[model samples]
Target chain A: MARATGCLAVSLGTALQICLLFGTASLLSVGGGNSVVPEIQLRAVDTYHWLSAAQFGDLFAIAQAAPGPSMLLVTLVGYKAGGVVGALLATVAMILPAGVIVHVVARFWQSSSGARWHVAMERGLAPVAIGLVAASGAIIARTTEHSPAQLALTAAATLVLCATKLNPLFLVAAAGIAGWLGLV
Target chain B: MSRDRPSSDVSLGRLAATFCQIALASFGGGLSAWSRKVVVEDRGWMTDEEFLSAMTLCRVLPGANQVNLAIYVGSKLRGPRGAVAAVLGLIAVPVLIVLVLGYLYFRNGSVPATQSILRGITAVAVAMTFAMAYKTGAKALRSLPAWVLCAASFLLSAVFRVPLPVMLAIVAPVALWWAWPARPDASP
Candidate 1:
């Protein structure tokens, strides 16, 4: 009886913690979800000790393989920590605050398209945004890269994507086949 | 710039399903490209310029840029209900798949075969990201100020290890000042 009650208490606490942590991440994702990856890692792996660093890495791989938003990682984290309820809480918490912010900004942006400041903002910030996108790619590359073979694959893929009209999903499939065959 | 705007006749369910189809198709990254293809080209929801600007705004706002984009398009089409349908449709399947993957991983433990498949997929995934960055960066690099900002941002955030927010704070002010709206008398 005591153990049952203790289990319930622990699960509830874990659920709440997931909500708070993910809620913070929701607001802090300034340059999209990737921007807050490190923070999310720290809290889930280091602070909470809910999962090991290795587990986090595996989860990341799984999230990448699955479809939808890359931010599905939060759902995985919440599931590991607290079960189904925790997963729901974490997913909702991760997206809701930012969703609200986005809706408000969208409304403002729709109305202010021709405003001078809006024009300036649209023009000025574009490069900065592009640069950030570039930086994110580089960061992801540095982390995943292992061998010269992998680097070559990346370069070839980039060229193919930029130079051809080939569908990207086919390229991804080819790469996956290579991996499955132990080629790449 | 005015072409046919999105028809007001687009039902809420269709809006949800369209976004869902996009989600299904976006196997890799580059949701923006697929978004443009579907919303701008196929559906004639908005002009390309409108989509690009909305995409830029979405990138800055918190949350997943694509998710925000769905909301932006949804709201533009059908008010608050539009947002609900779009977001729900976008995330529902992905969330389910992710949870299932999570379950399987822990249940079976790490298998060498699964890792192999994931690594391959991930390698291509990373490459897709590289292509996207290059494609977009090429466009931004057309202007000198934009190019300079791009190079500086890449160096600081990727190479020097400065955090994203800090890097943005350092570079954004300068970039924005350079690109600020021109005053009539100040024009050279």
Candidate 2:
């Protein structure tokens, strides 16, 4: 019983920590969830020891597979730590701050126009967002690339995606097959 | 800008419902297409040109593209309150579903069927992301300089493994220099 209580407390604490980290990250994630991968990997694998490196990769896969934002990995990690309550807590924590900020910003943005700083900031942020997106693609490729077949698939997919009008879902399906077949 | 323009005939409730439908239907991450289908094709809420303009604005704004989309659609249909209602409705169901699923998933790490489905979904998602990147890049890369910047950014990050923020610091100033409005007499 004491052990159970101790575990519960630990889980709750972990959930809270996850929320704070993710909340801050969410606000800063102007480029999207992929941009936060480096930080997430560092915390989840290096700092927390909640999961091994391979497990983090699996969680990332699960997050991408699921709908909504990729930042949903926070809920997955919280769930692993504590369960439903933890998941709920973590999700709220991660989403609420950014939601509120966006809401407020949208409201204000509607009325205000021709603000110099606002224009400057938007102009300044665009290239940063572009760079971050590229970095994120690279990071995902680095982690997911494991073998000759996987590398080939990744290159082919990237090239096809950049060059052709073919639907991306086909490539993903091919990659999954490769993964299942131990080709990657 | 007409601040006193009357609201569209679409009721707030209907607007909210439309947003919810979009959220639920966005199983894969092709939200831009899904949004286009719903807002422009199905509902006739906005014209294609209007939808595209709003999408551009949303992309430049901070926040999830979908959330920004809800805001734009809602604001167009009604006003500020409509925007709030639409965004809330869009997120409410997804959050609830994710919370419940998170509970089950945490309690039990992975079930075989679920794992298989997720694996399939992951592949689809990767494809969807690539498609989005390609589409967006085509629109954004209008000039040779812009294309060069894109290539430089990609190569720097992918090959050199430079941190994202650092790369941003390097590329942003260059983009600014290129995008900065020219003086009247400075034109060639």
Candidate 3:
């Protein structure tokens, strides 16, 4: 009976630890989910010893490929630490604080709509935002593209998407087939 | 081109389903593009200008850009409950999928051989992002100062790899100054 109680306590403690680690990471991830990847890796792999480095790498691949936000990486990490419950806790911790901040800001933005400063903000920020979007593309290209063929695919897709109103899903599907066939 | 604006009275279920579709459709990457398509183009929930600015605000703030976006759009449309619904829709299915993948990886001791397919998809994903940039830029980059600010932001972010906060610190002030609305009484 005592052992059982001790085990329960340890699991609860582990869950709490998951919350704390991910909660802090949630606030620190200013540049999006990828910003905190290294921090997560260092803590989870090096400090906590929850999983091997290889496992972390694989999870990252899985997260990127599985769809949705890659920040779901936290879910996997939490799963490793505490199973289903840990995963839920980690996810909530990761999103709640940051989500709250964005929500408040969104409300404020809405309330200030059509004001002169708001107009200034909308215009001034639009250019910078578009720039960041393009920068993300450049960064992703540098990291993901290896061969000239892949580069050509990206370039061609960009041109097609820009000039035409073609749905991008078709291009993405074709690229996948090319990859599966080892064409690119 | 700003057009008819959709009402924010979107039902919670619709918000959830819409975000769910957006999340699932972003297979390789470019979740942001998928978001813009659904939120601005298909649904008409927001104009290009509103969406662009909201996106930057989300990026500048903490957390995952997609999740933050989900929160922003959801809250705008339906308040706190809407935000919850959107986030759940966006992540619930994907989280389960990722968990399954994690299980398989841990069990089988290796990722399944989807590397090549992912490679191709990743390339397209990059393209999707570039396309998003081009599409939005055509509308936003109308002025020389706007072009300069966009270029500076792009260079700082892509080439110098300046951190976002620092880049924003350097560029935002100039952008705000240039874009500040002229006093109605004083300026032409």
Number of the predicted model whose lDDT against the real structure is largest? 3
lDDT of 1: 0.75
Summarize candidate 1's per-residue lDDT along A1-184 as a digit string, tens digits: 0112112234667777898999999999987898888999999989998788998988877776567888989988888887666677889999899999888889888887666666666666666666666676677768776767767887898899877767777877887788778776
Each candidate's iRMS in angstroms?
3.5, 5.8, 2.5
User: What ranges in model 3 sit over 4 Å off?
Assistant: A1-10, B1-5, B183-188
Please report how far candidate 3 places residue A159 from its true position, in Å.
1.1
CA shift of A9, model 3, Å: 11
- Each prediction's TM-score versus the true structure: 0.81, 0.61, 0.94
In model 3, what is the error at residue B22, expressed in angstroms? 0.9
Residue B72 of model 3, lDDT score = 92
Which ranges in model 1 have alpha carbons more than 4 Å from their true place? A1-17, A34-57, B1-10, B26-56, B137-140, B183-188
Q: What is the TM-score of chain A alone in each candidate?
A: 0.78, 0.59, 0.91
Residue range B28-131, candidate 2, lDDT tens digits = 34455556556755677764434543554554444555676777677656666777788767766766655556444445775234444343333344444444
lDDT tens digits, residues B1-116, model 1? Answer: 22344456678888899888788766645466567657865688975446656876787689988889999988888877898889888888888877777777777876334556
Ranking by lDDT: 3, 1, 2
Q: How accurate is chain B of model 3, given as a TM-score from 0 to 1?
A: 0.93
- Residue-level lDDT of model 3, residues A44-70, one tens digit each, is 899888888988998887888898999
DockQ (CA atoms), all models: 0.52, 0.22, 0.65
